[model samples]
Target: MTTIQPTHRRGATRLTDAGRDIATMLWRDTIRTARQPEMLVFAVVMGVFFLVLFNYVFGGAIGAGAEVDYLQFLVPGVFVITALQGAQQSSMGLATDLAEGVTDRFRSLPMSQVAVIAGRTLADAFRNLVGLALVALLALVMGYRFDSATGAVAAILLATAVGFGFSWLGAAIAAKVRQPDMVGMLSMFWLFPLMLASTAFAPADSMPGWLQPFATYQPISVASDAVRGLCDGALDTGDLVLAVGWTVGLLAVFAPLSIRIYTETD
Candidate 1:
C-alpha cells in the first residue's frame, strides 16, 4: 500500500510538471509576439486590406442578384480565410525558432518536448483570436451585420479552431525543414487552393459543376459555410457538426506528425 501510494504520487507529480512546462512554453511564445508588435500590425494590415479589396473590388458584381448584403456574407467568409492565413504565420514562426537554435535549448531541458509544438500552436491560436477580432471590427465598420448571436459566437469559435488545426501543418513543416522561408512557400501551396476553391470569396453553386463538389466538401469551405449560415441567422447543424469534425480531424492527424518530426530533428 505504501509503495503504491508513492508510485501514484510520482505519476501525479509528473503530470503536474508536464502541465507547468507546457504553460511556460506557451508564455514564452506569447511574449515573443508581444515583443514583436509588427506581427500584429501585419496581421491587421493584411486583414483590413482583404476586407477592403473584396468589399469594394468584387462585392458589387457578386452581390448583384442577391437580396442580402454582400459585405455581411463576405465578412464571415473573409474572417475564416484570414484565420487560415494566420495559421501560416504560425508555421513560419515555428520554423524560425528551429533554425535559430531555440528548439535545442528547449530540448536540453527536462521537459516534454511536445510542449514546444503545443505551446506554439496555443500561442498562435491566441494571437489569431486577436486578429479575428480586429477583422470582425473592420467588417462591422464596413457595415457587415450578424443576425444570430449564437451563430456569431459559433463562427468565431470554429474559425479559431480551424486556425489551430491548420497551424499544426505549419508546425510539421517547420519541424521537418527548419526553414522559415521554406515553410511560407510550402504552406502557400496548400493554403492557396484550399482557400480560393472554397465558397469564401464566391458562392459554390456559381462555380464550375465539376469543381463545385470538391470545393464544397473541403474543410475550409465546410467551415466557411458554417460561418456564413451563422452570420445570416440560418442555423445549419450539419455544417457546424462537419466543421467540428474537420477541426478535430486535422488536429488528430497532424499533431503526431509534428511532434514526431520535432522529436527526430536535430
Candidate 2:
C-alpha cells in the first residue's frame, strides 16, 4: 500500500536539510573570504578614512555648534556607515558570482537555493563585525570612550543587525541585476543619498528645514541615533524601536524577494 509520510516529519526533515545546506554554504564563503583578504581590508580602510576625515577636518565646527563632543557623535555613526559598506560588498560579491556562473553551479546542486544568498549575507555579517571592531579600537585610540562595555557591545550588535538587513536588500539587487558593475552603480544610488543626507556626520537640526524631517527619521538617522544612545549610556526607546523596525522591515521585504528573484533568474 502506498502511504504518505507524516507532514510534520517531512517539514522537520526539510528544515534540517536547509540548515545543513546553509552551514555548508557559509563555510564555503568563509574560506573564499579568507583567500581574498583584500575584501576585509577595503571595508576597514573606508571606515578609517571616514573616521579620520570627519574627526579632523570638520570635527571642531560641528562639535562646537552642536555643543557635543564630535568624536562621540561621529563614532557611532561611522559604525553604522561601516556596516552599510559591508552590505555593498555583499551586493558586489554576489553579483560577481552570478556573472561568473558560480550560481549556475549552485543551482545544479541538491540544496536549498536560498542558502546561497543566506550564507553570503552571514559571512558578510561576520566581516562587518571585524571591521566594526577595528574601527572602534581606532576610535578608542583617538580619544572616543564608550559609556560602558555593555553599551559598546550592544551598539556594535545593533549596527551589525542593521547591516544584515541591508545585506538582504543588496542581495535582492544582485539577484535581479546579475552584473557587478551595474550593482555597484545601483548601490551608490541608494547608499550615498541615505548616508550623506542622514544625521551620521552632523545633527539633523543643522540641516535646512526642508531636510530635517527626513534626516531625522530615515533608517540611517534612526540607526545612528540608536547606536549613539547605546554608546552614551542614554539609550532612547524611541530611536531603538525605530531602528529595529527599519531593520525588520528591510528583512521582511528583501529576504523572500531576493530568494524569489534568484530562483527565477536564468
Candidate 3:
C-alpha cells in the first residue's frame, strides 16, 4: 500500500494562512449574524440604553470638577462594558454550536483547527464594530462627539481586539464546561463584578476609601482611561502598552488554551 502523504499548504506563509482562515470564518459568522440579527440589535440597544441612563443618573453627582459632560466619561466606560458583553456573545455562540452538534461537524472537516477559534473571534470583532458604531451614532444624536476620528478609530480597534481576546477566553471556557447556561451565567457573573468593582462609573478617588486602591489599578479602569486618552488625543506610550498588554496578553494565554481544549475534547 502506498504511504499516505500529510497535507501540506505549499508556500502558504503563516500570515497568508491566518488571513485565509480568518476571512473564511468571518464570512461564516457574518452570514450567521445576518440570519440572526436579533443578537446584534440587542447589543446595540443595550449599549445605547446604558449610555443614556448613566449619563443622566450620575452625571451631576460626579460633578464637572470630576468630569465635564459626564457623557464623555460614560462613553469610555460604556465602550469597555460593551466589549465585555460582546465576549459573552462569543461564548454563547460556541456553546450553542457545541450543544447543537455543529462543532463536531467542523472537527470532521479538513479545515485548520486554529481556524475555528480565529474565525469565531474575527467574527466577534465585526460584531463589536457594529455595536460600537450604533452606540457612537446614538451618542452623536444625543450630542456626543469625538475630537479626532483617527484617535477614535484607534481606540475602537483596540476595543475590538480586547473583545476578540475575551471572546477566545470565553470560547475556551465554553468548550471545557460544555454547558451553555452555565457558560452564560458564569461569564456574566464575573463580568458584572469586574465592571462594577472598577472605575467605570466614577473615578477611583470618588470611590469609598476601602475600594479606591483596587479600583484605581483594575485592568478595566486602565483600559477605559486609555480609551479616553485616545479619544481626547492624549495618547501616551504607557496607555498603549497597557492596552496592548491586556489584549495580547489575554489572547496569548487563552487562544492556545482554547485550541488545546478543543483538540482534546470529545
lDDT per residue (tens digit) for residues 1-266 in model 2: 99876656577788999999999999999999989889999999999999999999999877874667889989999999999999999999999877776778989987899899999999999999999999999999999999999999999999999999999999999999989999999999999988999988988988999999999999999999999999999999999999999999999999999999999944
Q: Which stretches of candidate 1 lie above 4 Å from their native place?
A: 1-11
Candidate 3 or 2, higher TM-score: 2
Q: What is the TM-score of each candidate against the true structure?
A: 0.93, 0.95, 0.90
Model 1: per-residue lDDT, tens digit, 107-198? 78878888888898899898888988888887878777788667677777778998899999888888898888888889889899998999
Using lDDT as the measure, what is the rank order of every candidate, best first?
2, 1, 3
Model 2 sits at a Cα RMSD from the real structure of 2.8
Candidate 1 vs. true structure, TM-score: 0.93
lDDT score, residue 205, model 2? 85
Consecutive 10-residue window with the lowest summed lDDT within model 1: 1-10
**Model 1 lDDT, residue 64, Cα:** 90
Most accurate candidate by TM-score: 2
Model 3 C-alpha lDDT per residue in residues 1-266, reported as the tens digit of each score:
89887666566665687678768877887898789888888888778778988888767777556537788777877887788788888898887776766778888876677887777777777988889878878877888778799988887777677778788889899878868888988897768766888766777787789887777666677777787778778876786687678778888899899889888954
Residue pairs with backbone overlap in model 2: none
Compared with the true structure, the alpha-carbon lDDT of candidate 2 equals 0.94
Q: Which is the leading candidate under lDDT?
A: 2
